[model samples]
Target: MSINQSTIKKLYGLSAGRCNICKRVLIEEDVQIGEMAHVIAKNPGGPRGADNLANDNRYENLILLCSIDHTIVDSKPNDYPVSRLHQIKNDHEAYVFNRLSNNRGYFEDLLALNTLFKYIPILELRGMAMELPSRISNRFEAKDMFDNFIRGNPHLYPFKDRQLDRKWCSVISNMEILDCWILGSINGLNLITISDMYNSDPIPQPCYNIYVNDERGYMALNKRYLSPEQIDYVSTEVHRIVQDFIYSHTDLVHYIRNNFNEIEW
Candidate 1:
């Protein structure tokens, strides 16, 4: 049996598209330079091969690597034993999940820090404001407060100086969308019409629409109006971004907390 597409996807995702051995990124400029190296050789007589091992193409038996590392590992099977390879794979996958995944555990440690409480209210208020139509004014207030905090503190802006990982880029992009929506941009026009609020039927609307201007042009950001589903999605996304930001820039978050008394709200 050959390695299937699902297994390949899992392998690449778990490895974060990097070679397990050298931690070098396999995909460069949209070109794939990574190879799937088998822990147990596909053929019985091949390197690290055994008659007992069957169906070696499974994800559990595969490791992602650069062509160079693949050749080296296969050539010197004695040097890289099955046990060592398994350990390496486990460690690499764990590293990717904890450090690169959106739902990482890094932020959990920061929960105990007193400084974390300072920012929680802003995130909560923003979420609550979006869920209720009566709280529309609160939404604008929250946006201003959030923007001011980010603008006033230069240290919190990590995306400004260096190249960021894909995860961080996604977080920042979502934040930009949230900011745009809060500023009252319906579609790309920066103008909201009465028709934007109501559909063809005056009552019992199928969906409430919020538009965002993406590369494909204006598209619905949220389909439901002040819905629990929309609120949950926004809350989850905001929480992820905030948690990751705190984990990534712990010192900066603490800076805000330290000067909280002096900063004008």
Candidate 2:
């Protein structure tokens, strides 16, 4: 998903290259400015009114964050709570500078999201491949057979719908870290490749485990899988991820919104 370019400039101006959560002053050359955050999220209807300080992109609502903070708040708003957003307005006021309102969001004790980067691997792929039960000697046939089995029976596995309910802080934090890893583009191919018997698609390997991605179109497995427009798709993901580093907000839905229209044969 993507945001307007103006939003990026707004956030860059606000944070001045420093991460909002960690309060670490990132040297313009050193800190990688990641995203622009909404004090009150638009989804789940947090608040987007111009009259609301928390919702508007004023200095208070705006913050310059790293890739980690960007993903945490974007994916897990509750984890990066900020009560000060409510303090922005009363029932009638337009710009409540210091007083702050009473509304609620992710303003609890665990808002710092950078801590999770230490553990998350950045780019990891998890997929199933079909292989012989060890009795088959060719090895090649076993892998191919298992791959066929998985593709034929995707419904047999539940890996796609699994969820973990850890503390919001941990979950969001890791997600943020993962976003950076995908953006790192370090591997020979950038994203750590994973094999799949059933999932023929190659996902952009970010740090956090993909909990839910309704995205469609384009998965290029470098090793043994193929999908429609795989090369173009992988290239696009790399470009978009780079863009993500400059802007504070990246709406994946909006980013890949057009993919839905393609006819997948």
Candidate 3:
């Protein structure tokens, strides 16, 4: 089957407009330069033709390569085997994703928060809820409690959880905090509730649960490894990214304002 424009566009975006093999940046000027080479040749004797074609006409089987690298891979298909090509593709795509999400142009704190903002929406859209600490009241309450918890009990909030796997949960928690903070800032809301799902107290003892307002919502707190100072630093950085994005993409601002309310959060 012929490769569709959607497949091509998806491959380009997944590649971050760069060649997967040589990491050569593909821009409008070099539009005609890169080739999306198939990992498995379409020849009758090729390995895994059926499976490869099933995925090849799509993104997974295609690898973005410059003209030189494309010929090289195709020529030495034995040396650059399918599994090895897959590893290269996965690693390259991950590198691209990480770099764009965690841009270091801003200060470290701001850069992290910027990354959080950049990726959290994508994650949310993917059906992974931004899981926060047990019951963090409002945004202000979350900031105060989280600051104290992370600072006071760093040992408790290790990168690993009970399973000792899925260490990314800690990372997700931090991103969720940043996401909540951004939401509060954007909506001009004072109190941002992280998670209201509390059958019982989610946070246990040794970690203090200072009940500021039980009537307001459920309140539980533990550590997530971010300080108030970092929050303050990131606050300025958030403003910078938002302002820069708005200024550079005025059409986006217009689009957003045009359908501000119609957008489903």
List model 1 lDDT by residue over 1-265, tens digit each: 7789999999999999999989999998999999999899988888899998955789999999999999999999999999989999999999887675433222322322223235435334434433422223323343344456457654443332122323334434444444444444343332222233233333332343454334533233443444676455445544543454444344443444453333322
- Number of clashes in model 3? 1
Number of the top candidate by lDDT?
1
Model 2, global lDDT? 0.36
lDDT of each: 0.58, 0.36, 0.51
Q: Candidate 3 lDDT (Cα, whole model)?
A: 0.51
lDDT of 1 at 193: 25
Per-residue C-alpha lDDT of model 3 across residues 1-265, encoded as one tens digit per residue: 7889988998888888788878887665645677888887665365434542444576777888888888888777678988999998899989998886544322333333233333234223221212222233343232344445457555444322122213234333544445554454334322222221112233221222222234655343222433454334444544543343333234432433353333332
TM-score of each: 0.42, 0.23, 0.39
- Looking at candidate 1, the ten consecutive residues that score lowest on lDDT are 105-114
Please identify model 3 stretches exceeding 4 Å from their true place.
28-30, 45-55, 104-265
The order by descending TM-score is: 1, 3, 2
TM-score of 1: 0.42
The residue ranges of model 1 lying beyond 4 angstroms of the native Cα positions read: 101-265
Question: Which of 1 and 2 is the better model by TM-score?
Answer: 1
Q: What does candidate 2 score on TM?
A: 0.23
